[model samples]
Target chain A: MALSFKPIKPLLHTGTNASSRWFSYIGLGIGVLLLLCSVQMFINIQQLLKEGSIRKDGFDFVSITKNITNETMGQPEKNLFHADEIDAVKKQPFIAGVSPLLANDFRVQLSAGNVLPFSTDMFLEALDNDFIDTLPPNFTWKEGDQHIPIILSSDFFEIYNIFAPGQGLPQLSKETAMGIPVQISCYGSNNTVTFSGRIVAFSDRVNSVLVPKNFLQWANKAFGNKERQDASRLFLKLKDVNDPQLVRYLDAQHYVINRDKTLLGRNKIVLQGIFSGLGIFGLLVVILALMLFSFYLQLVIARSRQNLELLLTLGYSPQWLGKNVSKQFVPVYIFIVLAALLCTQIMQWAFHHFVMFDRPELSSLVNWMVVLLAAALVLMAVVTNARLVKKLLHGLG
Target chain B: MKLEIKNLLPTYFEEERKSTSEIWGKERSFSNGDLVNIVAPSGTGKTSLVHFLYKMRESYTGSISYDGKPLKQFSREAIAALRKDQVSIILQDMRLFEAQTILENLEIKRQLSPYHPQERIIEMARQLGVDHRLNALAQNCSYGEQQRAVIIRALLQPFDVLLMDEPFSHLDNANAKKATALILEEAARRKALVIFAELEKADHFPATHLYHL
Candidate 1:
């Protein structure tokens, strides 16, 4: 048997069907609600994670370090450490590795007596030869060959051309701990420096330069130290990123993880647990209200379908009747999705502005979930409407 | 138009009344293009007779054979074709849709016959003087217009029998004569059976057969 096409029924006009109008309103409403819920969930989860991060890692111990005030490096005061001082610390149990450094800040004159200040603050840091055991590998310096060999920073080339205002030529302040001390004044006409450092290492960071302990002693002698420590500061290494030992180590080292301003201050485990209870209550309220609204709108749409019965009576089959009814649901579902998505955004804004003291960034996951939920509801509503239309048809027949 | 009804009976069922005998009758014969006047007031089961004759529907007992085969032997699609193409009806209440325009209402009638195009609709409207009110909505149209529109729609198809239930109840004397003449003319032209629940306004027929229920 072969199937033949039936004559086409005239298309319903745009905005003509009353049923479509009802479905559109309902679908739009449902969509907006879902979108809003998703956004809320996103913001809530993000806030939870942010607060959690503060609670977990907000208290790291930092040992007070000082010694090599050698200014060859911009912050040579921060470089030198004492291994003997580290041994005196009660946090010796948590010790990882101790590294000491020497630094200098001075000017160097190139060929032709054109003396210029070397603005580069070079640092000579010495590791325990096992700094890798404590810090990650990518952060450690690997250099080959000693004298005449240098590890220049990425900004080393750039710093050479920098000019100081109101100064015609660069000048050097020769700091001497033991080596030859000579003061040089640069006249801009004859001062030109050449780049001769080996590119053993480079970093995008321009703050500090690195060298071995052997060179550090030379630099310390060249630039002179304000004060030298008895031993290096301790750099404790833990098996995991988070360890309770960090808190005790900070106490023994007289270090502190100040949290009165950061996220850690506001978060107490008990307080968050209470907030979670409130959030759950809020969720239940939303579901009940939204589901009721959805069911109400559905019934209203069902009543409008009674007017379409004459078509069915006039030889239109049930299946075609469903298609006719589906037109009503399409616009409604579209409206619902859009409205719900929009509502979610509004709610998220409101949550940040009014509800939460700390405005957490919205979660992408929650946003998408809201979208997905609203879409699913719209689809379900359409199918429900069609089924209702069918039941009505059977009743009329 | 030809039909065959064999041992037909109709019943109305209700929870309170249980079941009541409606039309306990049977028919077996072949009549072609006969102008029939089934003169039963309302609810004398004239619709039941026609319904059973065209095809035995729900709550109706006995099989109606169309052109010699048992109606039960026919598939749903086949019965649908018989109703849509072979047999057409003008419902008693006019059944004009409230949602459609006057032109649309008639167009639905025209659509019953796939072979007849829109040109035939213009022709039918012209003959019935409904061309002037082509754009008016259906419910807004006068009762007489609805009656004429329905009859014209039934005529649009090459129906074997045209079943009309008081299709001209609303037409006045002059328009009633015109509508009757037009309906009879089209029925005679096609040599189709025009079965109508006759009204006082129905024009006199010289040689037409009458069934006074």
Candidate 2:
């Protein structure tokens, strides 16, 4: 006797006033989105800061200098490097390559005809070709080329702008400065050599004005006094910048790091603390939303006590009824989570477009890590609400 | 299937009343297809007896077993399964969902057991004289119509036992006769035992066994 009957529709008693708690759903959505954004922002910022601080390729190089100490107090000659100390630093396991700064013991003067008041004596330090971030294909120079390529510190532009306005001098942009050629005259003990110096690039890591190693070697042979060029500083390439052993060893050896290459450890710590605090606050909001949802469910069950008991008498298991009732809210959960994910993606786009505007390395779409985080949050909400519904049904029993 | 009851005493009963009562100590057993009419006056715990047997009220001191398993040992799911597949009850208040139509009330039970076809449910309603009102909401129906609808609902399930708590309290003699004939016909077809609690058995009522609680 197969019954020709329709499926059992959910009774009025099993339904809920979920629409009345629309604010809770919106609250949870915002909370979850904020949580995801904070975590993603923290990840992106950390990656940006880490990439800015340390490089693992050939670019991961830092310049190290021995501090001016009491032992070398007015002895300018002793301020130069000793070969044994350089060899000891090179022998360390972390150092990939160590090159000494080739400082020509000569006087160099720069003149820009009527653009400068007088010829200014400038200090020149040259490094290896591998240290240049973007070495142009034609960066090399010959002995008679009379044209020297120079790299200036990025900070030099900022300092120039600060003083030039007060000094009534025109400020030079990077492009403007690149085209300007100035006269350079070098003086040693017996001879004087003249060349034209052209600005090539600005350096964020290598702080000093840089020149070609070949030009320095040639100039040293022709005009330098010392037979062996003693370096005052050394460039070191390490595998990892955040390695604790390297920092400890540098501190022990009384070495000074380049001022521009400071890592963002304390800044990252403060940022993580703030973002984690925001994450905790968002979690609290989600928890409060869940509590309100549970209360709403409880009220529905309470008001329908008699109808539920009647259902129980009709051979309906409370678990089955509870599941049916609990499943009614699954769509709400999906809608809120999808809404939150959509908003999070929008926020991520805004973040990459505006906040991380200039940093191409930090700009990215949503990471897989954030998707997992959102999935975890949805699972937490569903499982928690299901358990609450089951507990309430159990209480009815 | 058989139900056995021995030395049952409900905690809701007063201590002095328990001392003066004999029904609390009496033992009884009912087999399949046995029609037992429990005759008791008002405040005699007839509804309590039905509630206890249905496993709704647990504050009792006794052993009630279905087939050799004690009722106290059944888990909630097991109890619900027994209620779903083995027994049907027409509660005293005719617990048809007031917010639903008469056909919807019957469908609630009919969906649980697919063997009861819609035609048969409608046929039962026709025999009970409530077929014309089946589309109306239960709350809007007259008391007798609602009572017949509950009777039809209880019969829609395939039960080895049917429990009725004063099922015909609101029905007139003619309607009670028609409702009883339909219940007995369905019970006979399924070989289901019938238990009904009433204030008194009518002269025209045909009962196989009568017990004064």
Candidate 3:
């Protein structure tokens, strides 16, 4: 009787094509899941750092110190400080800028027909019109010789759309951006500007609505400093880059608190502990899964019935057959691990949608996780392989 | 091992359909180039003698040795080394790797064997009358083809002895003659011994060297 061998494929080194496809799917699913987690982790790290820097120096290279009185749910009214006393610190040379901001907690009835109840502590920067890169509130427009346009932050864009379908724009027509101005009834005077004002760019920091300095001053003066102080706080920026001298000058002020630096360190430790705990759990699950699903060498040896028979008759000892079979499966496992990692990295990139965490520390985490997964895969493959051999060769009389 | 079965004795417990039976046996040193034919009409322990010599059936009271050293005294690695270096077996059932080609099957054998000339395979192919199908997969080859390939593989080994069990069941008369000639030639070339279990007439092999059980 004729013995027919398996057919050859266009690709060399073929075996159990169905099994290979199953592994491919496993690798694909793993890759996509890992990618999702990786991107989220990366972006989370970036967010952490960005928030840290803002908390430290504040956006616009400025910090606010205000004396305020507000009603709190307390037995006795809490002692409140005055803004005029806070403005007195403007004489401090390190304090390069001072714009006392008077803001009140209020619910906003958005034009898109949604009510935003003020929840989180929201702060706004009272800016001068000439601050470069400052965008207008709630919109965007292209730049030109003289006209400065407004741009909306990503958060507002996702939440609101008018005239444009998706409402995302680096470039929008003059008509759409400049056709209708948003009316502000803040100081009860109900000031209105040309709804056709130009929009330039969006604020990269908090999802805050940006308006011109005139608009901010007008709103605040009409509403009164409410806190009853001449100035909210003195904002400061260093006169020169890497000027530690300015840092020293600021440090000399006893009121200077390293709140930013301290919080970053504390949060980093806390977050690290949490992620490490979760990562350990994940690693355990992966190990258990691999152990159960291992491509056992005994199975390979058992399946290699014809091969062993031929090798034995070919003057090879039972021992020799055992070793040769072990050698053969090495390449297969290596191929699987490598293919898995490659597909994983690709899926991660796809899931990220090209938005990677540019911060240094989080990127390092990405690198570490990739290496970690690769190592784990290899270890799992080898351990299961060796155990299977010992079992298969048991009682080889 | 000069395993002299001095005053050899054994015991067995055999449970039958409704009763049980036991038997005793004797053994001697398996000689070199002894075309050993172990025969018995029924259960007379013919195949058992070979099995005990190889220590494959170990529920016995006979001693096995290699170059005067006790088989049990050696480490597993040492025994494996001895098996590879000193003895080769053409197993009862023909077993081969399905993944390898016929040539690759032989090549694996040649690789495991000590240095042979580069043309050793071609020479063996020509002698076995399988030179035309060197690249065919061993699995794809017919039983006769696989049998010849296996015999050639055994011949390629630089070992002291060969164990055979009905190894020529698949060959035709002409091919069988060629294979027998090649075996005898390779045995003399390597100064090696061969033990074959014959299921046919012993008259085909040299009369002087044949031993019947």
Query: What are the TM-scores, per candidate, against the unseen true structure?
Result: 0.49, 0.69, 0.50
Q: How high is the TM-score of chain B in model 1?
A: 0.79
lDDT by residue (tens digit), candidate 2, A1-397: 4322223334534346767477678788878877888888778766776666656463467888777889977887677668888898889887787889877667888776565554568878888877766566666787788889888788876787678777776788989878878778899888887898888888876777778888888887778776656788888877656444566577788888754454454456567779889888888888888887787878777877766767777877777876776777777887887788787788888888887784777655777788898888888888887898788777775
lDDT of 1 by residue, B108-164 (tens): 645645546778777878877888777787778888787777777666666677777
Docking class for model 2 is acceptable
Q: For model 2, which pairs clash? A: none
Which candidate comes out best when scored by lDDT? Answer: 2
Question: Against the correct fold, how does model 3 do in TM-score?
Answer: 0.50
> Among these predicted structures, which one has the highest TM-score?
2
Off by over 4 Å in 1: A1-307, A345-367, B1-3, B12-24, B29-43, B51-59, B64-86, B98-101, B108-115, B135-142, B156-161, B171-181, B184-194, B199-213
Q: How well is each residue in A142-175 modelled by candidate 3, as lDDT tens digits? A: 3221222344455564444442444442333445
- Model 2 TM-score (B-chain only): 0.94
Between candidates 1 and 2, the one scoring higher on TM-score is 2
Model 3 chain A worst lDDT window (10 residues): A2-11
Can you give the lDDT of residue A181 in candidate 1?
24
